[model samples]
Each structure stands twice: as structure tokens, then as C-alpha cells.
Target: MNPRITDHPAVPYERTRRVAFTFEGRTLHGYEGEPVATALHAAGVRVLSRSFKYHRPRGIGLTCGAPSCPNCQLTIDGQYGVPGCATPLRGGESVRRERAWPSADHDLFGVIDRFSPFIRAGFQFRLFRRSPRLAHLAERVMGLIAGGGREVTPDAIARAARPGLGERRTALAVVGAGVAGLAGALAAADAGLEVVLVDQGAEPGGALRAETAPVRTPDGGAAPGFALAAELAARAAAHPAIEVLTGSTALGWYEGGVLPVHTPSGVLTLRPARLLVATGDYDQPLLFPGNDRPGVMVAGAVQRLVNIDHVRPGSRAVVVTRDAYGYAVAAQLCAVGVEIAALVDPRPGERAGADAEASFPSGVAASGVPHLTGHRLREALGRRTVTGVVVEPQEGVDGRGRAVRLDCDVVVVSAGRRPAEELLLQRLYHGDITLDPGPGTALPDGVAVAGGAAGITDPAEALTTGADAGARLARWSPENPALPEISPYPLSPGQAGRPSSSGGTSE
Candidate 1:
């Protein structure tokens, strides 16, 4: 049986309220609120979907829920495409794998992998086309092969699309309800500006929902971690001026701050005077052989599975990381009753020795769990799910060191994070702003960014930056006579832009 977490005394719902769902005509049971992808993983059902052409095996890579990777794309409720990791499993929900014939587990189209060399790019057309009639036939054949799911014709799209509701106007709109988005909303409301906060999750607080432990506060005191995410989420929900929309996703932005937000009920057109994109970050995966296995997961997803969903990822775990974030993950795994085989540090000996134990909590530190410094994960060994990790010393002689294999069912990787800047990038593309904004420039008016989305990882820094942005927007003036001018979100390492010159003063 898959290792399930049912030992947390603080959270009772972790073990109860099982909800059943159907996938590919097979009935499966999962928790009431957990993602369908997590439930599928717990049932050992990997390879959710196949690639368009080659049909290579795709398993959960990051489990990011953002669906940054195509590993977990599947059809839900007659929809031909959806991110299974991000899509929640409702009782009796029907899910099916897309782009795979017969089944995702045993796809007949997988034979295309053998002929991938002949089908590289448009080589097949050149190879098969002879005369005008033959070329037309070859084009038809290629189209049939390339199309994975049902044709998405204009008529089909119209049938599937939901009707748009009327528009709503707000003083300020925040795209995400994560750390930065929540902070921005609360600050803007506290500063007397009407605000609207939108998030994709069923609830607000973003990553804060997964953070259970206390973190160091700004003043060096202990705070309910995530800079009090629970407290902030509660306050935002109850704030008079702040309108919170859970399970709402900001689709896109247009000129004049016209935003199309996708809600479960329908589309909401938001004409906010100001917009803030604080969507936060997605976890980066480690690069190694067998990294795409079923049991391999990103550190953030593992935390969410344990703390938020109350699911144990595995019985034995190996954490491989380059930073202090990995230590925290190991501690969490240990607390959830998962055996931490070892903590592998890939940094050089000097840096690893100095900081390997810095982030470890007392429970993990005092347990005498083996800490392997300066060791790089050479490969993950297993046919399907992860079974063990082979590690070697980074500074060993002649690039060949004694390899140590740590047996573990799960491998949690915490390398770093990349900014979730898709929305920001899309908005920037519409304006005449160049991709490379010069260093230290102010930003365009009516737009602001904060938190992890702005590359600020420290929770304290994210909270402060978000509050600053909200406060500045509240006191915005044509001629800034009071507050020192705040810099824009960093375009590059040091590059920034001025606020939009045409932004009207706040009412």
C-alpha cells in the first residue's frame, strides 16, 4: 500500500472524509479536498498523460500545481485539457487521459517513439511528398498524427466556453492571494483603498496554508510562520474594503487595467484603477537521471502534501538540496513519521560544512540523522517509482568517488525557485516597454508587484515590499511631495522602471 499520513493529531481531517472519483473508468478514492493528481499518485497511478507526438512517459516532476510541466495534463469532466495537479478531485468526478489511445498506461501510439528520428520536425513531409496530390495526402497524414485530442475547432470552443458576466470596478486589484498578494490586499484595504484579491486555490493564503511551523519574525521574535499567513488570511476574508475571491484565476490584463478573471461560476471583467501581480514562485526541480520518476517530488509540493493535505509522500525519504530550504523539508518529513535516510548537500565542502546544519530544527538536528556534505545526487535508481538515490562526493579524486546509495521510496528535491512571471510578462508584452528596462528605473503607473513574484524570497521582505507597494499606491500623487519614490519590480538583476506617468491620483 502507498504510505499514507494519518498520524497528525492536530489535524483530524487528514485521515477521514474519503471522496471517491473515477479516472479512465476506474474508481479511486481520495481525500475530499486534495488535488486529483495527489490522489492518483497515492494510488500508484503514474504516467497520467502522453506527449503529443513521441508519446514518451510523463510522470509528476514538480507537482507544482501550476502545471508548468506537461506531465500531469488530463481531461476532466468532458474538458479535453486540464492540469490534474492543480485540479481538485470532487466526489464522483470523471477524469480521463488525453492524447493517448487505448490508455495512458498502455498507449498504442507509444510506438511512435521508435520513428521519432524520421519524424524530426518536418522531415516526414519532405520524405513522403512527391507530387502535388501526394503532398496534400502527406499533409493530411501528418495532421492526423500530430493532433492528439479532439479537434478544437471554433465551433467546439464556443460550445465549451462559458458566457461572460458584466464588469465590476474596483479601486485596486491583486492577481494572487499568496503571501505578497494577501499582504498587498490587506495593506491597501487598511490604507482606505477598495481592493479585490483573486486566487486560484479553493482558499486564500497561498503557500501559507502548507506552512505549519513558526518562522523568525522581522524583529527576531517567533511568528506563526509565513509571516502569520493564517492571521492575514482571516483578516483579509473579514476586511470590509477588501473583496476576496477564492477559486478565481486572473486570466489576462488589457489596456486601462481591464482584467479578465476566470471564476468557477463565470468570467469576471475587472476594471481596477491599479493592478498588482504577486503570483509568487514555482519550485525548480533537480537535474539528474530518473528525475521524472513517480515518487520524485519538489520540496514545496511535499510540504503541501504533508501539512495541507495530510498525506505522507513516502515511508523512507531522501532530501537532496543545494540550500538551507532542504533542511527544513527534511525536518518536516521526519515530523510526519517518514524516515529521512539522509540529507545530501551538493554545494562545495566549504559552504556545505558551514551551513549544512544551520536550518535544521532541533528535532532533526538532535536525531543524529546522517548529513552528507558536498555530495551530489548522481542518479535515482528504480524502474518506475523512486527506490534509492546514488550520491557521490563533489570533490573526490579524479571525478570518481565512492558512491553511496541511500535507499528511499521518495526523493524530495529543493534546488531553488523561479518567479511565476507569466502574467507579468504577458502584461509587459502589451505595452511599448522594452524587455530590458534599464537599471534603477521607476515602473509604469497603476501597476505594482510584491513578494516572491518580485524575486523577494524572504517572507519578511515579501511582507514589507507588499505593504510598501499598497501604501504608496494609496498615497499616489502626480508630484510626489511626501514619501520617497519607491523603485519598480526588478526587470533584470538591477534593472527597474518608473511607474506609469498617466496613472490618475487615488480617490
Candidate 2:
């Protein structure tokens, strides 16, 4: 469903050709050292590592190669570390599975699973208060041990990795290649604005790139959303004023429209007259029994694996959802031979799935896709990897329902998305860095929100939002300027795990 080879530039064509990479001394082939994460996954190395608190088992959570997770530490390149999810692999590269005191598979700390029963959600806090000395020490040690942090071999990869970005320039830079960022880029290009669209991937389309098959535009229109996205990318790429950074990931935003974007070559401190953030949402993992496992993945991750990567998450998948995105993705997967064991819609009262056939083809398109209303995951049965899921039926919720077991190798958690608002919390509206909910509630200045980040999601609004952000940035003037408005995605009344400080920093 990813818009037939996005008309936009893709990784600009690999120059070094393919090379061999070693995972645990086992040689595998890929586009010469692409990312260590990608190679391992293709080789069916599912359990990319293990867990943290309970040392339960873990795998490549996402493809970003965010380095190895301490929760599931390992030894890569002769060094003990976390697997860099996004790190590319080459002929000589070596990737080793975890080798802890006991082992990543069966860690001595894993006994925490047994104590998990007594340790409620925040058991550490209670223990700290009751037995401050040992509890506090244990918590600190545990926290440090579970830092889940990773260090990357920047020098090695940078020196060897080869990618190209022909000379191009833009007045404004848009971070995040999702729906909103793409929208901002398109609009800015249309208004004769010099725009630079950057994405972490090898393409331009943002989350729009993540989705499978074009669904209804915001309105019931026939815009050919995918085509539109590709066409716009093409148009912008061809436009003299617009430049696209396909593999460049924006690291962070700085004062005066300066963005430090990470490119394969080096850290690029992009200086622009204006900056459009447009960084969209990240899948929030749902809290449930046995939530941490190798086979359990975010809904967006499943969609990416199937559609973009052309990889199957599992032969059969059970999509647990409270959102339409999940349903649509599942439908697409089902269409392409991937079976949808069932579509678990948590809220039975919600009629989102009622018109499934309209949005996506029913029966074969979503065959065996029974929309289980009020269906909640009681537990997932898996010893090492996911084996199946357990469902508990809610009476009167589905009128027709009961406890059922669905056999599947994968569990897609489609809970919801939360804007990566760490930067937002780093700034303040009035006091420059005061705490309290951000009133701006949109992409902040020098940090324009677009795509899902701007809340311009899906078919229709994606285009408009991108264009709007671009236009605004292009038309920006000091003499008679416009003040920016940013809205946080999770701007609900109550949402958090900690407290905020006076400097707009969340603790």
C-alpha cells in the first residue's frame, strides 16, 4: 500500500552495491552494511535481545537501529552492548546475541518475573518508602542496570557507510517525513517557497509512507491519496526551490531556525530562516499481562514490516486496537495473504469498525476478520516468542461474544499515538521554560508541527497541512509576521508518569 515506489527520491540508489554482514559470526547478505538491524531481521533473527525489569525476552522493537537496548543487551563488533536497531550491516560486520552473566535468554535477574506478582505497577516506590536504605539502593542499581542505553560506533559507520545527497539548499527545513511534514513541504513548494523535506528513512513520505492502501481522504473524496503523495514528492523534488533529505534524520531543533539533522555523513546543523517540525506520533505500548515479548510489536511497526519492508510479521496476526489505523493496516495485511486472526476492537460501543467493508474490503479483504467488540487481551501465551493470545469477552458489549483463543505468532498493539513532545516539555510558552501544559498546543515556533505532528492525519488533511506549514513559513515576515500555534497530541486533562518543573522540563 505504500504508494507504488514513491515518486520521490529513494536512498538515491545504493552506490557501494551489496555486501556481507555477520550476525553472531553467521554471514548474511544485504545492501553492503545497510543497518545491522535490517539484516538480522531478514535472516529471521526475531529475538534481537531480552527484557529489562523481568529480563523477559525482547527483539528489535523498531527498525530504527536505535542501538542495542540495555533491557536486552548484547555483544556487537566484539564489544558488549545493545543492538543498534537502525545500524546497517556490511560484509565484515559482526552482530552477537546477548552474553550476560547467566545469559540474555535466562538472566539471573529474571527472577523478577516471579516477584512481579507482589510488585504492583509501582512496587519500587512502596519498597523504597518502607525499606528506604536497601530499597533505594536496589532501585538505583536496577535503574542503572536497566538504563537500556546504547553507544554506537559512529566513527566506523560514518567512515565506511556511503550515501549521497547532491548539492541542494532550502530556506526552511521540515523535520519528520510523516504526513504533516510532507504536507508542509508540498504547500511550501507550491507557494514558491524554498523547502527542504527531511525524513529518517530512505524516502520522503512520512507516516503516509507507513500506511497500506489509500483509505478515504478526510472527506469522502477520490484524491488518490497515495498518488497525490508520490506526485507531490515528485513535483517538489523536481522544483528548483525544494530539496528532499530522504535519509537525514533531524536530531533536534535549536534557536533561530537551526536544526541539527543526522545524516549518514555527519551531523548537519541545518540553518534555515524557518523550521517546520512536523514530527508525528510514536506508538504508545499498551500495558497488559506479558506485554513484553519478542513477537509483540506496535501496530505501526507491523504495518511498516509488511508494507514497506515487504516482510511478514507472522503467518497469522491478531490486531488489538481502539483505533481505525490498526484496522486498516490489518485489512491490508490480510489482503496480501497475511491472515488476520481477528480484529480486537476494545470499545464495543464505538462504531469505527461497523463500516469496515466501506473503508476496506470485507470478507476476503478482511476474511476471518471478525470485529470482536469489547474484546480485551487478558494475556498472551508465549514461552520465548509469541504463540497466541487470550481474550476475555465483555457481556452486553458485543451482544454476541465469549472467551476465545486465537492462534497467531504476532500481537500488534494498536493502542494509540503520543506526539514525541520531549522538545515541547523542554520549552515554555511565556516564561521561556516554565512548567504546566503547553498552551501553544501545536508545533512550536522554530518547531512547526505538520503531518500527524500537526494533527493533519490521513488522506486529505495530510496534503493540506504540509502545504499550509510550508506556505506559512514561506510567507513569514518580520514586518507583519504571524505568530505560531502548536498543539500537543496528548493534550488530555490527565496524562503522565512524572511531574513537571518550573522550567517547562518534565521529571
Candidate 3:
């Protein structure tokens, strides 16, 4: 089925600029600037690749904004191990599935999944141990098979050749162009400090780009998240003190505050007086049997697909969540004409008693959709793609209850989110830094953490923390008057939970 949504409430989908690309030698068309994975999904191509060991079918778990898994890897333009979700469709590019023989859809190696119980971890080391020659031969064969037949073409060789990286120096360097990063950059820039904002997305705004819900403004009014993002992005772009870099990734933090960034043109190294990391968080996948199936996707990924790319994940979906975010996803899906089979909440309580339900969009509740509380996902049932799901009450929490089965093509999971703290962890090991609970990490001089990475999940708090950090680094007062007061509710589901001192959820 074609899953492209032409009419969306928050996002406008106009396939005006169509571009053609070849996937496994078959020409496929999609809109320019959208992710290749999104294009394929719109074309009803669910299976993107195969798992490395079991050869089980895999698709996009998380979208391009935050790629936490290797499910959507492919060989693009002779380069191996390319992330399909992150790679944009620029037209005439060659994309091929990796780790599968013959084809990703009909792979001969798929039989290996049936025999996974026998092939345990380190099985290769145990086989043919007595014969050294046999062991060596087996190693060679295994390497060849695992390589996925990556071609060493001129494109790959040229890409591998790296001259000296370009260099830049700034007073403040902010990673992640999301709300937090934008606020930090603007705060520092207004304080007369030169700022550099870097983000891996095609545009600024971070998670706000995919957000369709109206955010609570400081003036007690409401505005769409995307609109706010646009306003911030435009201001940053026009600001003389701030240099905005989109489609750029921060490679790592090294000695002497050296931050190497990978841009579309080439690698650029930055040496800034102060660094602010507001990298945000990643969607966590729920654990269950058949959880890795093609049609099972994270809630944020579905949001990016529907709101950003205007591509419907599936015709019908079963949303499994523990918080109000799941209901928000169901509401968006319904808005785009996707039938909601059920909204399953694993929390143990009556639906009325759950505080999370307060955040559920009123439109979804009025739509006569089933809200199954006190139930947890038991299994996502299907062979390759999700066909249905089996859910049951929490054994001890919900008492004795009957199991329920819901049929749907997609299983939307809004389990939780983990902070993106790779850069912060890197500093802890390489520099003089002390880890603390919540957003209170004892960072070295000139280094700071903000937003979700700092355990500030609330959007208003994120902005406050970011502005405070920027102003503090500038030797100015941490209290920035330009930032808005923190609201009790941010008007975003799953974003209302308060961060505890132990870095856990107080909610």
C-alpha cells in the first residue's frame, strides 16, 4: 500500500520536485530533500536490510533526526555502511541493501534465523578448533560473508582520502540546533559573544521540526512547535554574531577543546572558548517478541515520517505507550487518516486515575478510539512486517485480566527516551569532569550541557538552562531576561515529566 499522505494538518505534503533513484537496480521516484528511507517507505518498501547475525528483516526503527539503531543501513553510491534514514534523496543515486544475499526481500540467508538457537555467540571460535588451517579458512569465509560484498569503487576511495580538515574559532560553540541550542546561541550572541551553532538535521529546530502540537508560550498563548522553530532559525540565520551550520555533525571532542565537525562539503575543526551540548534524546524501543520487525517503529520516528516527510507509516496502527506521548502519536496518526486500532497503556491503574491521560489530545478521545489501560504489550505478531499485536494486563500490577489481540500494520512504540550523552561521556574520560545526577554534571571549565542531554526534558527548562549556560560562559549574569518563564505544562505530551535529582523521572 502507498503510505504517502498528501493532506496533513500540521505538515503540507506537495510532491512537486520529484526525483528518481535506483534501489537494488530498480528505479524508484521520491521527492527531493526527503530522507531516502522515507521515500522507500512511501513506495511501500518496508524491509530495508537484514540483521547482521540472524539475517532477520529490518527497517527504519528511528528516522534521520536521531539514528540510534543500525536497522536502516545500506550501501549508497559504492560507499558501505551508509545510514539510509540520514541520507537525503538528491536524485540519481544508487542505493543497495547490505548483509543479504540475492535480495533483502527474498534472502537466502534468512534461513539462518530459524537456526539461530544453534549458532550462539562466539560459535565461530569453537568450530574446527583442532585444525588451524580449517579455522583460518572458516575465518576468511565468515569475513567475506559479513562484508556484504562492499565494492571498493573510485567514489569510496575518494571519500576515504582526507586532506587537512578546515578550521574555525568561535567564542561559543553549540551542538544541536534544537530549541536548547538555538536559545544558547542567541543568548551568547546577544551577550556580544561570537557563536557557532551546529546541527546534523537538514534544518534547524531539532525535534520541533517534527512536532505538530501547539506549545505553551510564556505569554499564556499557544503556537505550533514548527512555527517557533522557523522563527528561531530565521533569527539565527540573520544574526551577525551567530553562524548557523545545518546538515553538519559533530564528530568528537578532543584535546584542547578541539571539536571536529563533519559538514556536507568537508570536515571542519572548531576551537571555541566555551562549548554547549544540547544534543537532546533518542526514542527508546520497547522490548517484546518480534519487536525488531519492519513495521514496528519508534514514536518519534513515526512523527518525523508523518509530520516532516508527510509519509504515512502504515494504514492502521497499534500504539503501545506508558505515557501521554503515545496518545499524541495516535492523535497525529488519526489526523492523517490512519485508523487507530487501539491505544495501549502499560501503566497499572484505571484510565481516569492516570495523570498522563490528562495530556492526551481531546480530538483523539472524542474520536471513539479504544483506550486500553493497565495493559502491556506481550508480543508483536508477524513474519516480516507487523500484522497484529498481543497484549495482556501486567501480571502483578493489574491483577487477573484477559489478553487482547489487536490487528494493525504498524505498531507505534512510545516507551521512553534516553539522553544523547556521547559527547559528555567522552569529556568525562578524556578531561577533568565529574558526573552528577540529573543536569548537574560537574563539567570542566568552558564546557556545559543543556536540554535533554542535561536531563532537562521540559522545553521551557531546556531553554532556561541553555540561556543560563550561555550567559554564564560569557561572564554575564546567568539570569537572562530575554528567555520566557518556565510553564507548568509545556503543552507537549511526554515532555511534562519532571526530572528527579537521581536523574530519574519524578512523574
Please list the C-alpha lDDT of all candidates, in the order they appear: 0.71, 0.58, 0.75
RMSD of each: 5.9, 7.5, 5.1
Rank all candidate structures by their lDDT, best first, as comma-separated numbers.
3, 1, 2
Best by lDDT: 3
Stretches of candidate 3 exceeding 4 Å from the true structure: 13-16, 62-68, 128-136, 159-163, 351-365, 436-440, 476-507
Tell me model 3's lDDT, rounded to 2 decimals. 0.75
What's the ranking of the predictions by TM-score, best on top?
3, 1, 2
Candidate 3's residue-wise lDDT over 1-507, tens digit each?
458777687765567589999988799999999988888888888999988878889987633335356888888888888888888899998999888888889888889889999988878768877887887887777666665444688978797566656788888899998877888788889999999999988888887777766665445776676776777789899999999889888988988888998887778899987888878877777889999999899887888888888888999999887766666677788888999898887676564224334544354457677777777899999887889999988766763568989999999998767677777677677755665554435555566667777656555566666777777667632344333322121112133233222112100
Highest-scoring model, TM-score: 3
Q: Write the per-residue lDDT of candidate 2 for residues 1-507, one digit (tens) a residue.
A: 221122222211223466876765567766553446555666666676655566566765532212113433456665556345545455676667652335555666666767777867667777777677878777777765553344556764455455544333357777766556666776776777677777776666554554535434444655333454565567667877667777676665545545666686766667776777666555667787767777778766665555555456667788887666666666666655667788777676446455355446544233546667777888888877788998877565763556788898888876666555443444433234334365434343434555544333444554555566667676764444465442223222113211001001000
Candidate 1 Cα errors over 4 Å, as ranges:
9-16, 61-67, 111-147, 151-160, 218-220, 353-355, 362-368, 395-400, 435-437, 440-442, 477-484, 493-507
lDDT of 3 at 260: 94
The weakest ten consecutive residues by lDDT in model 2 span 498-507
